[model samples]
Target: MELQRLRDVFRTALDLPADAPVDDLHYQDHEKWDSLAHMSLIAALEDEFDVMIDTEDVINMSSFGEATRILGKYGVDFNG
Candidate 1:
């Protein structure tokens, strides 16, 4: 559920299609995931997860999987 929500957030922020595979997405790799989109993604993630992401984590969140791991640090459980 949480994972799906994360994917949804990614889709919305990056303007990706519903079926777009976000798991392997990386910043700058996707045309839509520019610096502006990165900040938007961070804000969306913060709002969706109800957690404040720090600068280091923001910089570290270069990929979808990395974002999941960072959110885990904020107690956003991904395990079923």
Candidate 2:
């Protein structure tokens, strides 16, 4: 599940590389992840996880690592 989430995040957030390092993800650290991309990312994540992320979380999600942590709060177990 974690791997799938990571992959989805990467595919949605273009700032990340094909093989992005999950431990070092950040939004402002890349060019492709602009405002539009972030919106797309949120949509993708919501569809993939089948959860409606809050607006605050959408704004606060600035990295893959941050996303993982935030989603975990919503019962997305990474251990899977």
Candidate 3:
């Protein structure tokens, strides 16, 4: 559901493999998750989830798990 969609967005934005484990990924830690990729990831997330992310939240989104928590603030439910 929403979690899978978020994973898909991460995969597409970061150009990751379909089976890549995103839960533990951190910005600038992953080879592909650079600054440019971070912006792409943010845009993809906003588009996919239909929410406008704040600048502070964008800066705070340093990890995949953190992204999930931030999205939760925007009404995205990870728990079914």
lDDT of 2 by residue, 1-80 (tens): 67576675666556555666555657757667778888988887787778899999999998888888888887788877
* TM-score of model 2 (CA atoms): 0.79
State candidate 1's TM-score.
Answer: 0.97
lDDT of 3 by residue, 20-40 (tens): 999899999989999999999
The positional error of residue 62 in candidate 1, measured at the CA in angstroms, is 0.4
**Could you list the CA RMSD of all candidates, in the order they appear?**
0.5, 2.1, 0.5
lDDT of 2: 0.76
Model 1 lDDT tens row, 2-59: 9999999999999999999999999999999999999999999999999999999999
Worst 10 residues of 3 by lDDT: 16-25
For model 3, the superposed segments whose C-alpha errors exceed 4 Å read: none
TM-score between candidate 3 and the true structure: 0.97
- Pick by lDDT: which candidate is best? 1
Model 1 segments more than 4 A misplaced: none
Q: Model 1, 64: alpha-carbon shift in Å?
A: 0.2
Q: lDDT for model 3, on a 0 to 1 scale?
A: 0.96
